[model samples]
Target: MAARGEVSTGVSADSEPEPGWLPDAAIVLSGGRGSRLGGTPKGRVRVGDIPLLDGVLDAVSAAGIQRAVVVGHPPSLERAGVVVTREDPPFAGPLAGVAAGLLALPDLPGKAWVMVLACDLPRAGEVIPLLLTGSPAEDDGAGVARERVQGADGWLVVDDAGRRQWLAGCYRIGPLRAACAAASTEGPDGLVGLPLRAAFGRLHLREVPDPHGASADVDTPEDLMRARAAARRSHRERMES
Candidate 1:
């Protein structure tokens, strides 16, 4: 997209125009079945004495995500007022959830920034807005943040041991939609591993390893405990600061 952190209106810096005052919009990816956690809806799992999804919603709201749509089953998503959805055809995991969000398009309530975030993250505060860093304007349908890492699998930025989380990622509506459309034609299974790597290799894109501390996500019970400890430490540090 537009140069990392360097925003404008159009695709290029010079073409960047004034953006419309978008209200605020988002997509909470709550469609996972948490198969690794014994089919438990990870979004509904409690953490920090609150439902995991609640922790995520709090961050999105904190970052100004006023109008949001959730993707998941009703029983799995008890969060009120969140417009819920499901994985579109081909049911190709999280990508479909994101596609459903992109399909919502300009129709999103308030017509604002359509951010997509997952519920299993350790913290969502810092990374919420960091996703919008590459945005040219508030409504130019721009921006995308590379999850940040230190190696070539650098794409494996926030992986815990081996699980490569993707839904926790975010992107602006423009390039995101293009990516989805391209993925759709080739079918779902073709978007990961070698194929996925090749797809990203062909884009005229910018990679930013600027993920915030909140980017970490927990999968196992041990991971959960670590996340809680981390959160507690962060709170203590913030208060002291």
Candidate 2:
């Protein structure tokens, strides 16, 4: 955790994972103010005909994860068919949403790997599966160095520019829960006010490179427009070829 959207490197993945290895759950954060897009809920915004959140959820489902927690306003998540939760006092920020989402899951053992994603990733369906490929298991004994915990703890995808995308990573539930618990102690509002970077710094994280450039998340009006254009372009390309 450097700052929000800051890049940090040093951790690396081990050998390829066993066949059929995948996360057991996903936590999709949908609670953004959309201040750059006129205060609209980013989850509710449509890139084409599909809502941004829907696309992300579809990707999660396609990746063989049935258990998902969507943290956002109830109204926006009503029909998503996943656990819809919200951070207390609302608009607390991404870390608070992560806490809320973690709280929504049932207590179960070995369901350690959890995929964390943002609602605005238009290409989530394709990108998420790619991220899951060749992931290291928690028991790999990769050892921690320079604050980087190898194996099971989790790996996040970095963009082409080698920037780590905190919201677009997979994490181990045990460490994630512990981090949330520790971050909750900071203020009367609990984890709601915690910056994601500050909270995640507590975990041992590695980075995966995103060569396909599918981790783009819509944050501004221009981003929305680009998403729409990309969707249309993809559709046209598919129809033509």
Candidate 3:
């Protein structure tokens, strides 16, 4: 088992705050099987003029996350540009990919927030700031877990709300690493899904408005179409600006 907590690059957080934001790096989880797309690599799919991973990387860039660690599957990781890695055990699922990312860059010297992202999202780029802002630091190794309202209210809130989107989470790598390692027992089911919850029951989750960008993913062809339209709209706004 490869210790996924090894940091070997410049992605580490520095002692001084470059600007006003907490220095951090994004560990994008892009190794999932786009089952609805006939097993196509969602990261390669075009969302507007750029590939899915491009949009994700841009989002991380905009958030002041200078460095990125992409954990993709097979040739998907072979893409040119940016720092990329692959799943430790190939297609073992998103958890495996996430673990690979955590391992690839451990002890980010200056970074505090490790934004975990999925590649199938169409609007994640526009919606990540909301999660990064106002999020509390995990003074302890627990982490900043989001909680929402009651389950009956729906599965979106950030608090201990009977609802939450575990995948679209951010945290300090220390606790997250320990939690993930402990959750390894659950295999793919662990990590950002159920096992993560089990390991860190007392996580510090914050609640947002349940932005669709953080929740929606391009799974099926219909989803792709929707994502394309959204992406085009965003691109147009940027071009006009």
lDDT of 3 by residue, 1-241 (tens): 1112222232222221112343256777777677778777888888787788777777766665666788875243433334778875567666667677888876563224566777766667655765544333332322222232111111112433335555566555665676667777765544544433554444444445443445577778998888788777877999999
Candidate 1 at residue 2, lDDT? 26
- Per-model TM-score, in order, reads 0.64, 0.82, 0.68
1-241, model 1: which lDDT tens digit per residue? 3232232222222222223222245677776677776777878776667777878888766654456677665354444446677765423466677767666555532212345677787576665654544331223435332222111111212332433334444334555566666775675354422233233333233333333345676677787788878778877899999
Better of 1 and 2 by lDDT: 2
On the 0 to 100 scale, the lDDT of residue 61 in model 3 is: 65
Candidate 2 wrongly placed segments (more than 4 Å): 1-16, 74-81, 134-152
Count of backbone collisions within predicted model 1: 3
What range of 10 consecutive residues in model 2 has the weakest lDDT sum? 1-10
Compared with the true structure, all predictions reach lDDT values of 0.52, 0.73, 0.58
What clash pairs does model 2 have? 137-152, 138-152
Minimal lDDT window, size 10, model 3: 148-157
Off by over 4 Å in 3: 1-19, 74-81, 109-111, 134-163, 186-202, 211-214, 234-241
lDDT of 2 by residue, 187-229 (tens): 6878766788767888878776677788988988888999999
Ranking by TM-score: 2, 3, 1
Better of 1 and 2 by TM-score: 2
Residue 164, model 1, lDDT = 32
